[model samples]
Target: MNALYHCISKYHSIPSGAWDALCKTLTKVEIPRNSFLVKEGMVCNNLYFLEKGCLRGYYNLDGKEVTYWFGFEDNFVTSFYSFISRKPSVENIQALEDSALWSISFEALNQLFDAHKDLERLVRIINEQYYIRLEERFMAMQFKTARERYEQLIENSPHILHRISLGQTASYLGISQETLSRIRSQG
Candidate 1:
């Protein structure tokens, strides 16, 4: 798919043969809204690349679902700790809408990575990107006002407000729904 090609190209130049080989391992899947891709306590064996729709990763905290991140079209979503370590995940990955995705099992991906060093490079770059985004989010929560954080969220993912539920958005922004409502009204 073009999304896969674009992602690889953005991270590093891959040989055509290697790209094709990697693509072959990916399988297309269609998931319904509200379906769980990775449930808490289950090992996440697959890395999913969104072809359409959206997904959210959340953790249950004090009987509340606190969203950590969202993935939209052309983005990748996975319980990285679970996938890499082959351990149970603490987060739940759920579809926000009916979605299509390309997924490859962790075993298959590791095999491909072993066969192609360039794939390892691409994976490292992607991991670093994820880390940077998480760091930015942490800093925003610590230092930025709620309104500023909301504004930055809009700048980073313009369609997020439209696509995800307000409850999830509030969780992601680490605000109460009422607070998010006030921020939205004041904006």
Candidate 2:
């Protein structure tokens, strides 16, 4: 919880009353390994602050799961488009390990936004950060070779290789296990 508070404070500081109100709306949730926090075609009604463990967000492409991103402790997780638009999500968010989270419903968060302008600014900044990362990923996918992508991933997020399976890492890097193996062996 303190980590969550610190994360929020780093974005923007809200009034104590608004913080209390926001805290009151948060609910604790526990998800076991390999379980889903959200699934395709479901409306994501809550935003989660991960307290422990790891999660992955992915889309199913012709029966294959293509991982887009991962979230670990002290980070907020949500199906952003679905949460904001109240539409069904095309992606799934799954727990990689036994995870604990603090969740706030869409309605509760919106209410907080209405009541606290600072909270809204904080969310906007967070969304901007999300978009920046998304663009970086898009550029990497567009311009970089598979080997370069793998190298960039290893350089930027080496912890991912340690925390997830090689198969999952390969999926995230937009490569197959064999290709990843070949590249790793070349190093």
Q: Estimate each model's TM-score.
A: 0.96, 0.97
Candidate 1: Cα lDDT at 176: 98
Span of 10 residues, lowest total lDDT, candidate 2: 10-19
Off by over 4 Å in 1: none
**Model 2 superposed RMSD (Cα):** 1.0
Per residue, candidate 1 scores C-alpha lDDT tens digits across 1-187 of 8887886688789888788888899999999999989999999999988988899999999999999999988787899999989999999999999999999999898899999988878888888988888899899999999899999999988799889889999999999999999999987
lDDT of 2: 0.92
Report clash pairs, candidate 2: none
**lDDT agreement with native, every candidate:** 0.91, 0.92
| Model 1: worst 10 consecutive residues (lDDT sum) | 3-12
